[model samples]
Target: MKPLLLEIGTEELPVGALPGLAQALFDGVVDGLVKRGVAIERDDAKPLYSPRRLAVLLPGVAAEQPEQRSEVLGPYVNIALDAEGQPTRALQGFAAKAGVDWTRLERTTDNKGERFVHRAVTPGAATAALLPEVLAEAIAGMPIPKPMRWGTRDSGFARPVHWLVLLHGEDVVEAALFGVRSDRMSRGHRFMHEGPVWIAAPGDYVDALRAAHVLVDPDERRERIVREVREAARAVGGVARVDDGNLEQVNCLVEWPDAVTCSFDEEFLAVPAEALVATMETNQKFFPVLDEGGRLTPHFIGVANIESKDPAEIRKGYERVIRPRFADARFFFEEDLKQGLASMNEGLRTVTYQAKLGSVADKVARVAALAESIAPKVGVEPALARRAAELSKADLQSRLVNEFPELQGIAGRHYAAAAGEPAEIAAAIDEAWMPRFAADAIAPSPLGRTLTIAERLDTLAGGFRAGLKPTGNKDPFALRRNALALARTLVEAGIDLDLDAALEAAGADVAEVREFILDRLRHYYAEQGVPPQQFEAVAATHPQSPADFDRRLKAIAEFALLPEAEALAAANKRIRNILRKAEGAIPQRVDAALFAEDAERELAEAVDAAIADTDTALAQRDYVAVLGRLARLRPQVDAFFDQVMVNADDPAIRGNRLALLQRLADRLGSVAAIEHLSS
Candidate 1:
């Protein structure tokens, strides 16, 4: 095995594009080597990057491709020879194409009968010999959204390539990549190092760059930035609010990181902290400082690319660049306050939510009505939920949200509180958009949860009505995400409202929207390790409420583990098939007197007793207990199928037997259609 390294040094890449570019290059190189019949050790390939370069290191790469064998099939043995069994032109022609003599070929038999075949073994090429094409292909396959050319060359890349380092152990791979010749030398930090750093081997790459003030490993740079920024915030008696996204972007923006403590005017702290933090983190890559109480402070930390000789001058530059952004945020906040949240919401009348779906004001009205109807079901005050729904979209008209769109819900919460609305109502304004993405938490307050459900229902109904349903990654209306969020909120939040009722309140087709929500539930449960058939078993019943659906699924999952579950499910499936084939509609009530066999008599008693025992459990929504009670009848169910035949000569007996089987199937399916669980 030999150690391998490939580096593409270029002009500074976009901070947002660096991570993706590095990952693409690494995957492409490993895939290239594997496709070429090269062996690589598990976990041996890894991506490394700084602002100016993307590199991949393979610690255990094979020195050459594995030797491969080729087989060429010729005409059948009978057709390849004359009646005397001598070589013919057909065999000769095959041998000539295979570069072998006719006598040297072997005869093999397969489904097609006997045939003459030629096999050849070729020596593998050295890894060095294949590096050129492999490197070129990997580079060409990079996901550069906007590639550009340099000088007079038509070739383009994410950025202009200045250096290429391709090393195999201690030797150069001898290749050209991105218009640069492969070599052992790599560029270092732009300001800290004056010349190229020589890599003696693939293993020496990281250490060589580190010594020249370039931390090529992105993880190392991120850790250093986080540590330095925290320490800098500590010096000013505050803690650094190091968001993961801001940290990642800052890590990609610098090769050598130096954290500098800076301060803005204390008056700027009067503005909403979100607006200030947004300006600092989004416009300028700076970590905001918060006091021990978790409130934004005047102090912030900025990571510089170079370790300046005079730290104060660098701090002044950081402070100077952020002042205007903060000032604008303060102005926007003060101006928005003058208009008040209520007056600003009136502007939604003119703003279009969707052309066919009417304006944002129309959506707000629909959501308010739905929230009002849903509040009583969820045990929240109807007036509070409706009020929250009304003001939810007011933030979209705020100047602060206009400048920073991420602050839409957050800004509304602030404005509502300032306008003297109830605190819960204020919180609901923001929490209405809770679970903005997957993996986020749902609304914690009952009022918030109600408003959230109402808002999503209206959007889903409007979108589906407008014919904007999702198809193949093109969910212009985000219906799939909306459905999941709606389902999750309903089930996980312990909200007991019927989903169909809520959909009807929003003017949506109850049956159509129910299936849409359940489809999303299928995907949602799949991630939780529930098999598709398990989901289908519960979904087959078509529960009208997500909470009801969730209960049935949980009960079915537990019941599936019981030893008797399989027999019961299979019996239920057989019962359903038998009923489908009956000549007429099966009677709801079975006549016990018409039973002609002892097995039929026993099954009727068992079904009656099971229903009597589980009636209370089913009514109480204790599906687990209900399914368990029904599972106890599995022995009787299996016996009935074994000893009794439903089609009797007497019509009265046949109809009674069919009614008995119908009862059994209904009792078993009350919780879920167990037949779908049968293998």
Candidate 2:
């Protein structure tokens, strides 16, 4: 057995390319080694890479592949025999091609009856001899997301291949790939170090590269980036609030990292802090600055490839980058405010919500009408709700939104105040899009909450009417997110809203959205370990309202608690079984005059009372109370089944019993289609 190492060195590759290429190289090598009959022990393997090199380290790979014996089917017995009962020319020819003598052939049965088969044993080849070919194919087969072709060869990669290293336990192994020859060399940090260093074996892969100024482990590189960046920011008495996503992108962009702090003009701070940070982190991948009071400062941090020979020169270069970005942001903010809330409202006329449904102006009108209609139901003044809805989407057309795009409603709030709008109106303008994600807080002001619901309802209804319902995991329109936000808003506001009524007022456009939300409830119930059928049953009856369906589902689940709930479920199953057997068979009458047993009369009376009580409770919306009362009839019903002959010779008696069973099923179904429950 011997340890092995293979490194593919190239010029600076994209930071994004390293992760996937490293994984592909590892998979390709392991698959190749296994195919060559090399046993790879767990303790003998490692795969790591930086931007400049991809390498695999394996210990104790077997010296040769295991030998195998296989049976090779040949000509049938009929074809192999001659007229004299001796082997024919065809049989001799088959044996010759198989490299076996006729006497060594074994007779066996084939699909057409008897046939001749030959046995051959293949001995494994030397591991060293197989390595070069396997390594060549695997490297050539590496799945680059997109590849290129360079030099005279047809092969293309993330970057042009410069060198290859293949080692077998400190001994050089000859392997060529994509027109490049194997060697023991690897390069280090693109700027700080250049040329190559010899790798002794798989064991020296990481430390050897480190000594040559490369940080090969991605995690170690990430930690170093974070630590040095924060330390550099702190030295300037400012905190570096680096967004997690930006930090990751920055980490991959460097090999040997240097954290650098820089400043910009303080006057640029007049632009909203959000736009400033977005420009820095998004466009430049720089960390933002925060003061002791938690306000954003006019400073930022960036990770540089090499520490500057002159610190002032680097700072000036960074300043040059942020100044233009800030200038554009400031211009957009001031221009958006000058348009005023009234002018922004006019721009909404040209914005289309959906192709088939009409423009955003049409949607705003529908939402405004719906909001006024729903406001009184939720205890908000109708005038206030209408006013809020009118202003909600006006900010969407603002110049600030035109520039940042992400700051739609946010910029609206600032502009509204600058234009001398009322405090409540300005707050509503901002709050309209209060929740943009799962963890975001819902809007709380009275008008703001009203406007939020109105907008979501309008979007949902319009999409539903347009036939773009969510399917499977494909919610391209984010309909589920809107539904979740609506549910959370209702619960948090402690507002008792009739979801069906609110949707109806939102307009006929979103009926499909309502159905989509109902479909989503099955997932919510399933995650709680409650059967989806239980939720479906409730939903089938109250599909328009999530709160109502949830209420009914909870009641049915609680009713399933009584000792006889399972028994009733079982009894209902039996009744269904009987009904299925008696398909198309009807009992025409249940003659009370033909009643012959006390159990029969008792069961009929119990069912009648349970039905009456269930009806009363249901009329009052007391679902749990109805379920509690229905459980009392289960025992009596079970007793009747035990004592009475349901298919009695007396026709009148049989009909009455059939009718009673139907009554029991009806009451149980009112709560839930109990027959649908799985045991």
Candidate 3:
């Protein structure tokens, strides 16, 4: 085994593009090696990247490709031979092309009938001989959204390539990538290293780069940045708020990192903390410092590419660059306050939400009406819910929100509070967009939850009514996310609103929208480790209430663990198949006089007793108890299917047996269609 290394040195890459490029390079190289029959463990391939380079190191790679068996198909066997059973002209030509004697060719039979084939074992080639093609393939497959050409060269890449390194053990792999000749030399930090750093062997790459003042490994660079930022913040008597995004961007912006503490004017601290943090993190890529109470301090930490001799100068430069952005934020905040949230809402009338869905103000009106209707259902005051919904989109017209679109809801919360609105209303304005992303928290207040559901419903209704449902990856309206958020709020938050009725109230097709919501639930529960079949069982009944659907699913999951679950599920399936084939509709009422067989009589009795015992449990929505009670009838159910035949020659007997099975199936399916659980 030999260690393998490949590095592509380039001009500074976009910070946002570094991580994805590294992963894509690693995957492409690993796939290339595997496809060429070069043995290498997946875990043995390591990705190392900094702002100026992307590298993949393989610790244990085969020195040569494995010997392989080759086969080539020829003409059909019958056509390959003459009437006398001697080789024909076609067989002779095929054997010659395959470099084998006609007699050595074998006959094989497949779905398409007999065919003549050539088979042989061939020796493998050295891994070094295949490196040029493999390396080219890996580079050609990089995920460069926009490839650039440098000089007059035809080759295009994410960035202009300056150097290439391809080494196998102590030997340099002869190849040219991105119009640059592959060699053992790699460039380091442009300022720290004077020239190219020579790597003696594949294993010496990391140490050689480190000695040149470059942390080639992104993970190590990120850790260093984080530790330095925290220490810098500690020096100023505050804790550093190093968001993951800022840390990652900083990691990609520098090959050598040094965190410097800087501060702005104390008056700038009066700006909304979110606006300040956004400006610092987004525009400047700086980590803000916070007091013990989680309030933003004037001090912020900026990551520098070099360790300056006069650190005070670097600090001053950092503070100098951020002052204008802070002033802009402060001005935007004060100006927005003067307009007030209600006044800002007036500007929404001219903003279009969608071409066919009317203006933003129209959406607000619809959402407000829906919120008023759903408020009482979720135990919130109708007036409060309507007020929150009305002002939720007002932030879109704010200067801060226009500058930082991600702060839409956050800005509304701040503005509403400044206007002296009720705390619930202020919080609800922001919470209405709760679960802005998959991992975000749902609304905490009842009023917030109510408004969230109402807003999402209006969006869904308007989008679908405009014929803009999501198809493939083109969800311009984000219907999938809207549906999942609605379902999560209803089921996880314990809201008992009828999803179907809510859709109807919003002027959406109730049946179609209900299916859409349930489809999202199917995926939502599967992600939580629930089986698709478990969700389908409850979904088969098409429950209108998401809460009821959730309860039934919980019962089904627990019931599935019972030893009798398989037999019960299988029996339910059998009953359904029988009912489908019946001559006519099965009578709802089962007559005892028609129960001639003992198994049928016993099943009827068990059905009656189970239904009688489960009435209170079902009414209370005690699904677990209801399912457990139904499990007791599995023995009688099994016996009826085993001994009684539904298609008996006697018309009365067949009808009675069909009705009996129908009653049993209805009782079992009242909670869930257990038949879906069958294997």
**What is the C-alpha local distance difference test score of each model?**
0.90, 0.77, 0.90
Q: Give candidate 1 regions above 4 Å deviation.
A: 82-92
Q: Evaluate residue 519 in candidate 2 and report its C-alpha lDDT on the 0 to 100 scale.
A: 57
Write one digit per residue (lDDT tens) for candidate 2, span 1-679: 7878888887766766677778777778889988766787647354677767787777667777888678888888888988777889989999999987898899888568998999878898777788888776676777677776787887678788889988888877877777888878877777777778778786787788878778777777788988988898788888889777788778767777788889888898888888898888888989987988878987888888776677778778888988888999999888877777888898878887788888888888988988887787567789878877788788788766777887877787787778777778778878878687756898978788788878778778777777776777887667888777776676467555777677777665445556666655566567779877577657656533455566678887887777877877778878867655653445554456767898888887887788776787887667899878887887787788899877788656666677767767767767666655547
Pull out the clashing pairs in model 1: none
1-679: candidate 1 lDDT, tens digit per residue = 8889999999999889899989998988899889999988747456899989999998888999988888888999888999999978988888898888899998899998999988889988898998888878888888888998888888899999999999988999898865688899999999989999999999999999999999998888988999999999999999999988899999999999999999999999889898899988988989999999999999999999999999999999999999999889889999999999988999999999999989999999999999998998888989888889999999899999999998878999999999999999999998898888898999999998998899999999998889898889799888988999999999997677777777887888878888899889899999999988789998888786888899999999999999999988888889899989999878878988898889999989999999999999999899999999899998788788889988998888999999999888888999999999888
lDDT of 3 by residue, 285-363 (tens): 9999999999999999999998788999999899989999989988999999999998899999999999998899999
Regions of candidate 2 where Cα sits further than 4 Å from its true position: 1-7, 11-49, 53-121, 124-146, 166-174, 236-238, 374-381, 420-431, 434-453, 464-515, 518-543, 547-679
Q: Which ranges of candidate 3 are over 4 A from the true structure? A: 76-78, 83-86, 101-116
By lDDT, the candidates rank as 1, 3, 2
> What is the lDDT for 193 in model 2?
74
